[model samples]
Target: MHHFFSMMFSLLAIIGHVSGQPAKGGSERNIDRPYRSELTVSNGMYWGSWGYKSMCPIGRYAAGFSLKVESPVGRDDDTALNGIRLHCIDRSTGSSDSYDYTTIESDVGSWGVWTDIKWCYSGYLTAFQLKVESSQGNGDDTAANNIKFTCTGGYYLQGDGTNWGKWGNWSPTCMGKGICGIKTRIEAPQGKGDDTTLNDVRMFCCD
Candidate 1:
């Protein structure tokens, strides 16, 4: 009987030890969760553009980019987009110089749903801006009606050009230039319908 009691005590002690302490290694309490933002429109079939612009003191730096767009599935009569194209332009040049051009297609499984777009900068760029556009049938290119941009990683310079500061930490640098930022533009073709309404937009910075 004493041995049986000792075993029960041991089991209880084990249970107490397990419950007394906080979870170890943090336990993935917050990981890989979806981030969200939103854009709204009163018109049903028209195209609208909205975004923010800021000047980052850090001019010459490389950074990562991303964007999430939640768009309602087009009806049977409406023509759906075949793909989305992203353009990174150097605004300082005034010559439409571009750093990167990426296309996200519906088949890539990143569109129609809450689609995410990501890219990395290969060289130092100053005064950078992004443009997202959509394409339909052959010879039909339409700018995204609802778009969002996210800066997930990289260095951003703070302050003005002469008094620049480097923002090494990952933070949302919306519009203009910096770490995490987004600029959205919407364009509707003549016959598609009215302006497109966006359900949501989300941007995030990663560690």
Candidate 2:
């Protein structure tokens, strides 16, 4: 009787293993489908921005801007931004498109500022402009502080790098149907006895 019971148990074990194979295969297929869906959603949008600031003056100073961008996670990971352009506006001259900075593709983390010291022939730059274009439809949105800078020349410089140059007294120049100008003031360096003066600086942007 014992020998008979052992043989029955072995036969039952074999049958159970055969039946479980199909269920395991089905579960694997189901698990793969949802993972692919999540990947698709994560790769939809691209994010980035340009942060600006002013530097000390030593006869000439080239300011720099920082950029942060995120590529799609998975689906269109191969897709890349074409490039970014930087421009400077001169309000005094009423001339737009003062300078053209470098261009680069989408990067993972925050990139250092695009300094005028490196690109400027001399350490001289009046204002800045920035614009970002991407291959994707819903490219990204920039932050307001994206264009912050120090008060060196007694005025604030703000504009789309073209159309509007610099302005003074914190007033609007290209007010109607044109690019809006940014207002600024020059802060007298510490320990220097001078009154705070406000002035208008030129605008700049990337293409």
Candidate 3:
């Protein structure tokens, strides 16, 4: 009778184990899903009188960034934009950090193309700073006026105090259609104070 009870207990344990096992297709259905997120654009500042604005609003949840350089129609031939960098947010820790990218300022009349996108090692991009030169408004004057970012989902909480570019005085309102883009107004070739020739323009997206 003792042996019989022991065998019955062992049989019951086997049945429980078999019943607890996953179904034939259960493992496939239980696989984890891939991560996904959306982009959020934030309007940066319009610093200085001739501050340039980005082509697209920098996404708050920026995965990467690019810079824009211009060679004004009637200004210096030597000066131009070189490169750009970014400040990223470590989403896991909610901390801010910086990433840099520089270019060779060798070409002449070469309106520098957008630099390759630089991704955050850990998180998304939040803010940006520029490398500019004001040759007292001299000839061949070049400076950076605009920047853009590639963004992902939930990068910035609304009013979470993420940094945007500088915001200068608002431009005159559009006559009929709403303002959807920006353009810089430079003090080109000015030979006195700062010759901020690469005046900046920005886009104004309406919510």
Off by over 4 Å in 2: 1-54, 57-60, 63-117, 133-207
- Against the hidden reference, what TM-scores do the models get? 0.25, 0.20, 0.30
Q: Looking at candidate 2, what is the lDDT of residue 53?
A: 24
Q: What's every prediction's RMSD, in angstroms?
A: 20.5, 28.0, 25.6
lDDT string, candidate 1, 89-126, tens digits: 22344312234321111111112322243334332222
lDDT of 3 by residue, 33-138 (tens): 2112212223322223533332212222323443433334343343344223222222443434342211111111113344444555454433332333333333
Off by over 4 Å in 1: 1-46, 54-62, 70-117, 124-142, 145-182, 186-193, 197-207
lDDT of each: 0.27, 0.23, 0.31
Deviation of model 3 at 70, angstroms:
7.1
TM-score-sorted candidate list, best first: 3, 1, 2
Evaluation by lDDT, superior candidate among 2 and 3 = 3
- Per-residue lDDT tens digits for candidate 2, residues 22-119, read 12112211111111000011111233222222211111112222222223233322211211222222233332233422221111112112222222
Best by TM-score: 3
The candidate with the higher TM-score, 1 or 2, is 1
